[model samples]
Target: MVVSSVEKPIAKQPHASRLYRELAPAYEAVWPILARKRIRAAIGNLELDAGHRLLEVGVGTGMSLDSYPQSIDITGVDLSTEMLAQAQRLVEEERWSNVRLLPMNAEELLFDDSSFDVVTSFHVISVVSDPRRMMREVVRVCKPGGKILIVNHFRSNNSWIARMVDSAGAVTRRLGWRTDLNLHEITADFPLRVERCYKTSPTSLFTILTATKLDA
Candidate 1:
């Protein structure tokens, strides 16, 4: 008698597979290029040394891959399988052996405590449903004295820019994104101390923050 084999379906994290399947194509197309340049500049200014273990949440299309040192060990997580599929392709096409991709939520991570030397996110907070939980998780997994690097566009405090951001919220939401929250509000939830922040042009829309996770 001959026996047949059965293949198990790959399980996905909740609420993410749909969003990723729908949005992954567009996100993969433009984001990799658009975010690449900005992130490179931001990481360059960070002065990170080689051989660091880094965690990148919402690492769509692996744009930040170029910013990290080749000697570093990097792991990237995203909720979208479609996005991860694209990321995998990018990594393979580029022959990057130091990077690993996993499907995960920023609000919850499966990694052990203090597993990473740096936790970074690029333009992610504005879109996640629970930024506070995500921030806390990021801090939790980072080693003592590790840095959290965030480059994001946020709601403007300026009246005119605030109006524009508010107006854009509806459209952005339909496409599965949240309007940028005030940085001050989110930062208050963490014990982190801001090392530096830079305001990019077209104000009230974009900001870059670098914070160091405090030791317990």
Candidate 2:
């Protein structure tokens, strides 16, 4: 899974860049309200230690900064510089000296193998064109036995409910989300063992799964 600096650009279209930039401002205002309960529940489930080296993909506005223990070393990456600027502002104001934010795509992470003890992404899978590639990159940088935490929403499994999700997905897709993603299918492709899996909400709109990288 070693990648080089000469790797091809991860974002294939200019529209994707423009799309995120456009949503960055709206996201800051709306995401906290829409996702607060789910985020709090998910963060409560994370099992992190003081010395963990954590990498958070798509750290928009740094909403989850307070979830990490003060003693842990945290590195956050996002595709939007505008969003990262907000995250930086929050991190600086909170006096989180050990945390750093960088602008990077989840599909092509610029890090050495096994560099992190915990890798996480919150509500980002549906927006990425290649979520499988992003998961692979997350696993690539995570050490053997390290943790990978995901909190996201996908189409419900219940046929009746799934139909409703599909309908809503149609509208949301135009705003950069594939709401019909089969998360179970995506998780199967990764080299990780499930440590915990649970639903955060009854409607199946939100889920939290924590897993560990298998030894090579």
Q: How many pairs of residues collide in model 1? A: 1
Model 1: lowest-lDDT 10 consecutive positions? 1-10
Error of 1 at 104 (Å): 0.8
Name the regions of candidate 1 deviating beyond 4 angstroms: 1-17, 202-204
Q: How accurate is candidate 1 locally (lDDT)?
A: 0.78
Backbone clashes for every candidate come to 1, 0
Stretches > 4 Å off in candidate 2? 1-16
Top candidate by TM-score: 2
lDDT of each: 0.78, 0.82
Q: Candidate 1 lDDT, tens digit per residue, 1-71?
A: 00111122334354444776787888677666666767887788776778889999988777788778888
TM-scores for all predictions: 0.88, 0.91
Shift in Å, residue 54, candidate 1: 0.4
